[model samples]
Structures are given as C-alpha cells and as structure tokens.
Target: MIQKLRQSGTLLGFVLILLFFALKLPDTFLTARNLINISQQLSMLAVVAATMTIVMVMNDFDLSVGSMASLSGIVAAMIFTAGYPVWVGLSAGLLVGVLGGLFNGFLVSVVGILPFVATLGTLTVFSGMAFLLSDGKTIFGRDIPTSFSGFARSGIEIGDIKIPMLTITAGLVIFICWCILEHTNFGRRLYAIGGNKEASHLAGIKVVRLRLIAFSLTGLGAAGAGLMYAARVASANPTQGSGLMLDAIAAVFLGMTMSRRGEPKVIYTLVGVLILGVLDNGMTQLRVDSYVREILVGLIVLAAVSVSSLSKRRQS
Candidate 1:
C-alpha cells in the first residue's frame, strides 16, 4: 500500500486539488465551459512538458526551450507579416527550432559541454535572436491572416462540449511523444544511456547520436508550442515563451513522482502539466495575486523534487 501510494501520489494530489477547487468555486469551477477553457490554456504547456520528458529520460535538460520557442514564433510571425504563405511561415519557425536544437545537441554531445551550460547559453542567444527579429515588438494586427489567427480560435464540438483545436493539436503531439518514448527501441536505448552512460557506451549504444536526436525533438516541441501560442493569440512577441523553461521543468519534476524509479515519462508529464494548469486556473479564479501564485508554484516544485529524490535514494 505504501509503495502504491508513493507511485500514485501525483494523481491523488490532482484529484484532491480538483475537489478543493470545485468546492470553493462551486459556481464556476465545475462548469463545462470553464473546464474547456482550462484545457485550452494548458495545451501548449502540455506539449512542451511531454517532449521535456524525452530529454529528461536521457538525463539531459534543455534550458533553451523557452527561448527557442520565442524565437521560432517570431520567425514565423515575421514571415507572415511579410505576406508569405502561412505554411511557409510555419515551416520556417519549425526549421529554426530544429537548427537550434541541433546546435545545442552538438555543443553538449560533441563539444563535451554540459547540458545545462550549453542550453543556458543557447537560451540567451535565442532570446536575442527573437528580439532582433521583431525589433523587440509584438507581431499582430492586419498583417496576420485570418487563417493563421483562426488556428487557435477554431475547434470541434462534441455534444455539449466544445474542444479547441489547440487541445487536439497538443493531444496529437503528446500521443506521438508517448509512442516514441514508450514503444520505440530508440527510447529503450535512451533509458539505458540515462541509467548508466558509460555502461551503455560500452554496450555499443551510439550515445551521442541518440542524445542529439532527443535534444532536437525537444527543440521541435518547443517551437511547435510557440507557433500554437502565436496562432491562438494572433500575435508573437520576443518574450512570449520566457516562462516556459521553468514551467516545463517543474511539470517534469512533478511527473517524476509518478515513476517508481523516479524517472520521467510522457504520461506522467502530462499529469504534471495538468496539475500546474489546475493550480493556476484555480488560483486565478480565487483572485490570488500573481506573485503569490509564483511563490506557491515554486514551493510545489521544490516538494516534487524532494519526493523524486527520496524515491531514487530508496531505489539505490
């Protein structure tokens, strides 16, 4: 029973949080409309968190994800404002993210730089590039096509529930990430490498190549998220994804609690994202101050890390 609780604590916490909010905000929290709104708001974060799981499973981190996301969005927005096709802008944004990911992977895997340091440096570089691209301004207004802006605003209806397209898009991305990490041989090798890098290398795993791919995936996820945000709001800004890095990290750490071995997993990360989403949405409904909300979130993250640490210690 104790072991089971340890493994399922995050899910339990999520349920309890739901109950608390439902009771406190009886008039608003349980409404189908508000529930859908929460899903829409968290969709982008979920995608980033899901991909972050892949990077974390290989015992690597990508601090530049947020900055890469911001830059990617700006790249797409600039192209859009330049009267380019929507697909062209989207592709350019995605390409920027991929290239940035490759650069980070090369620095860490080939140049032997630490993951933290490499991504951190790239974070600054990407953020600067975003600012340069937009001249530190937001991209919006008449220049953005209805098709592009409509991307975020569109959705499908199911009986009484309206599901935003963003939610569906995020779901597809999460599902794909889950399949890659849970079903593929590549994912198995990543876990092996994370477990013991030297041993995996001795066992003939191409550690560097795999790591490069993982980081690139991370970049791709971040960029995908950025584009979603831009489409939803019908605008892009240099600082749009500034907070994504910490939020994604927190979500992943919260998710590690769901793993018996305290390793990150895609499904667990989605749960973590949901938890963060719940907390944010609940607090907002209660009119909680933004700074206080940040403080509480930080504490929750610290607690999650502590739980994961304890789990790893017991395993060892």
Candidate 2:
C-alpha cells in the first residue's frame, strides 16, 4: 500500500505541476501553437533520450552521441551541398552514425577500454571531424533541396492544433522503443546486464555483443536526430549538436526516476522529456532569465533523483 501511494504521489505531483503551468501560462503554454512549438523543440532530444535509455539499460554509456550527431549533420549538409540527392545524403549520414557507434563498441568490447573513456575519446575525435568537414563554417545555401525542407515543414492539422511531422515521428519512435524494451528477449538480457553484468554473463548472455549493439543503436538514433534537425533548420553548423549531451542525459535520468525501474523505459523517457519541455516553455512564457531556468531545471532533476534514491532504499 505504501509503495502504491509513493508511486501515485510521484505521478500526481508531476500532473499537478503540469496543470499549474498550463493554467498560469494559458495564453502561451496552453495554446495549440505553443504545444506544437514545444513538440518540435524537443523532438531531437527525445530521439537522443530513446537511445540513451537503451544504452543505460545495458549498463553502458555513450558520451559520443552529441559528437556523432554533429558529424552526421555535417556530412549530410556536405552531401547536399555537393549536389548529391537528398536520399543519398541521408543515407550517408546514417552510415556515418553507424560507423561511429561500431567504433565505440569495438573499443569497449574488443579493446577492453571502459565505456566512458572509449566514448569520451571518440566524442572529441568526432567533434573535430565535424569542424574539419565543415571548415568551421555553417552550411547555408539556396541549393538545399525542397524535398528535404518539406520533410521538416510538413505537419498535420486537427482543428486549430497543428502537429509537426517530426513530432509524430518522435511519438512513433518512442512507441517502437518501448515495444523493444518491454516485449523482447533482447530487452530482458539488457536489463539483466544492467542489474548484474557478472550474473548475466554467468547465465550465458552475450554481454559484450549486447553492449555493442546498444551503443550502435544509440549512434543510429543520434544520427537520425541530426538529420531531422538539419531538415528543420535548413542548414548545419559544426556546433549544431553542442549541449545536446546534457539534455539527453538529463532526460534519461528523469525518465528513470519516473519509471522506478532497474532499467530505463522509453515511455518514461518521453514523459520526462515532455516534462522538461513544459518547464522550459512555462519559464520562457513568464520571461524567466535563461540562467534562472537552468538553475530551476537542475534543482528539479536533483530533487527527483533524491526521491528515487530514497524510494529504492525503502524497497530494499
């Protein structure tokens, strides 16, 4: 009964906060336009969070996600600027993302490097590559294809509410990720590894291989996000992916707290990302200073983590 109450309390608190912000900022936060804007703003973060959840569930981390995303975006832009077809550019971007992931996986699994160190090294290398490829300049030109632009611009309208295509894509990706994590043996192995790597290995799980796959998927997701970002902005810069690492990590941790699971869950991650978006939107509507918003977000995350830790202790 107490556990149920705790769970309910956590959910109820989140709901109340959301409602309060909606009511307080009805003209800005609760409007359809703002809701659509929030969706578009957080779509990339949502993608990155999905992959981060997978990696965390496998007891590993990928610090190179932001770098990989930047590199992918640069490559995509270079391809398009070089007159290649949009599909070709997208494929090249995704391929590069996969290669980056595989490289990180090889280092961690085959070379016996720690996941953190391996990804950190790759992160720096990939970021440098992005800058080198772009010649430290943002890629912007009229030659950018119309199809690509439409990919990001297109939306669905329901009454007065307009939803961006990328927003719908994000929802689909989250649902697919949730299905993978909750309904598959691979997912079970991932959670088992997170709970106890040694136990999972002793049970004949291919822990190393699974970890590699997780990292690869993380890279894939980040690259996909970069493509969407480029499509939305119609250009790519070397610094396009900067700061994404922090947002992605925060979303993952927030999701974990809400899920109260040993392993990360996609649905919870999406919810957490929405919570963050709402907070940011609400603060912006109130004309809150950017620094103050950051501080508030940091405090909220810290409090959530503390609560989650305390709950775990009680359960134990």
Indicate which candidate wins on TM-score. 1
Candidate 1 local accuracy as lDDT? 0.90
RMSD of each: 1.4, 1.6
Q: Which regions of candidate 1 fall more than 4 Å away from where they truly are?
A: 311-316
**Which lDDT tens digits does candidate 1 get at residues 196-302?**
98999999999999999999999999999999988888899999998888899999989988887778899999989998998999999999999999898888777
* Candidate 2 residue-wise lDDT, 100-122, digit = tens: 89889889877989989999999
User: Model 2 scores what on Cα lDDT?
Assistant: 0.84
Candidate 2 has its poorest 10 consecutive residues by lDDT at: 1-10
Give per-candidate clash totals. Answer: 0, 0
For candidate 1, the TM-score is: 0.96
What are the Cα lDDT values of the candidates? 0.90, 0.84
User: Looking at candidate 2, what is the lDDT of residue 262?
Assistant: 34
